[model samples]
Target: MTKNISPPEALIYAMVTVSAADRAITTDELNRIGSIVRELPPFRAYTDDWLADAAQDCGKLLRKPHGVENVLDLVKATLTPELYETAYVLCAEVAASDLAVHHEEEKFLALLASNLEMDDLVCAALRRAARARHHQL
Candidate 1:
């Protein structure tokens, strides 16, 4: 049976996965993530307290072992196909933000796509976009 999940929760899960991909979350990355989160339509009307709460929740989840899969599952179960695709693209953007995509990050991204049941073609497109973004940096 499928589990129920919320869009806001799914987004937060995606962000948390990206943040933990590199094994260490840098301040710059965290700030960038915060900026991205603030700009998300779902969070458009969100106050500072709401953002903080989400970030804290993400942090708490990250502290647990092997939580990425759980997060990915939650996101996949909640998001519609279009939203999942968009989230994958956003994840690529976040992964490429540091000007380099670490091996672990790439693997994490692949795992995320797999968990979300995204097609290989779509994943490839997202990966290409991420590479393009990295080159532009």
Candidate 2:
């Protein structure tokens, strides 16, 4: 049911990568990812099945040695400038989905910011927003 699949799939893959980086994927993380695809403006046109396909594709990529860098490069290449921060924010949201950022997730976030070459201020703001939004209080 994936239609017109393209670079945006990289976005989903990025989220999935974050979810699995700790060697475990939580229900909250999975729900947050699904909600992102279903309700986020950027994904309004994206298909449900595309999420599964993207996640699976990312799993395969991570099985390789340099898959993390490779997948991030694909994301940086595909996302428009406007969407660059959006991708970072989505990753941040997934990172915070479990109520705390794991060490592995922190490393992935740093790597993502480095690869995206995001503005330091923008990255800080997105990180705060994602944490605030997902806070378990």
Candidate 3:
């Protein structure tokens, strides 16, 4: 098992995983992650420097055996049940920030939803919100 991580760190891992799901993390995605960390209420106590560190730590952990599963388990363990939806929404935001959700990103979201025991209807609503927020005319 990975070391016990803070809730903020767990959320960061979720975003990073979603960002990297497509194997090509885009500039838009990176900006979205940064913005989420800087603006989100959950991350209010988290510093900008810690954002980079947490993302790096998540990446290194992901290089290990069964990394994705391990990270998901860590996130599920670290966050309170109440924050599961928050975690999912944050990830969905990142995945949709570039105005496109790739196949890999969709897969990651499904895995995250399963790991967090999120309701399918809630996930659908969150995904729709993310898409609507990121949509441009």
Candidate 4:
């Protein structure tokens, strides 16, 4: 039986997948994801333990053929137009949390931006914000 994830869960899974894209999900990335869930208003009702289940579901989806595309489809369906930017921002934060956007992570973000019809300028701004937040200096 296939388990379906809710919109909020989808958002969390998306972040998890991006962090895992580089094949090395750093401690910083996981901590950032956890913080987002714990502190964000949108995720107030979501429990912390659900992160693992969502991540595992995302892994299963990605293992299938055209999994990335499939995941994008899920994202589009789960998120409303107004919330699209929120999704992009969340994904960007995860991608940049480690202070380094790996090639795979960058590719995933680009695809996510395209899928969500996010404006390039907006994406640039979001990326800048994410980088700034994680900047050590």
The candidates, ranked best first by lDDT, are 3, 4, 2, 1
Q: Write the per-residue lDDT of candidate 2 for residues 63-109, one digit (tens) a residue.
A: 88888887887777777778888888898999898897999988888
Where is model 1 more than 4 Å wrong at Cα? 1-5, 134-137
lDDT by residue for model 4 (1-137), tens: 23566778878868977888888989999999999989998889877667777777888888888888888888888888888888889999999888889999999999999989989999999989988888886
lDDT of 3: 0.94
What's the true lDDT of residue 35 in model 4?
95
Per-residue accuracy of model 1 over 31-98 as CA lDDT, tens digit each: 76677777878767667677667657766666667667667766777888878887787778777777
Backbone clashes in model 3, listed as residue pairs: none
Q: Rank the candidates by TM-score, best first.
A: 3, 4, 2, 1
- Estimate the overall C-alpha local distance difference test score of candidate 2: 0.83
- Over 1-137, each residue of candidate 3 has an lDDT whose tens digit, in order, gives 78999999999999999999888999999999999888888899988899999999999998899989999999999999999999999999999999999999999999999999999999999999999999898
Pick by lDDT: which candidate is best?
3
Per-prediction TM-score to the true structure, in the order listed: 0.82, 0.90, 0.98, 0.93
lDDT score of residue 60 within candidate 1: 68
Deviating ranges (above 4 Å) for candidate 2: 1-5
Model 1 scores what on Cα lDDT? Answer: 0.73
Model 2: lDDT of residue 29: 94
Candidate 3 Cα outliers beyond 4 Å, as residue runs: none
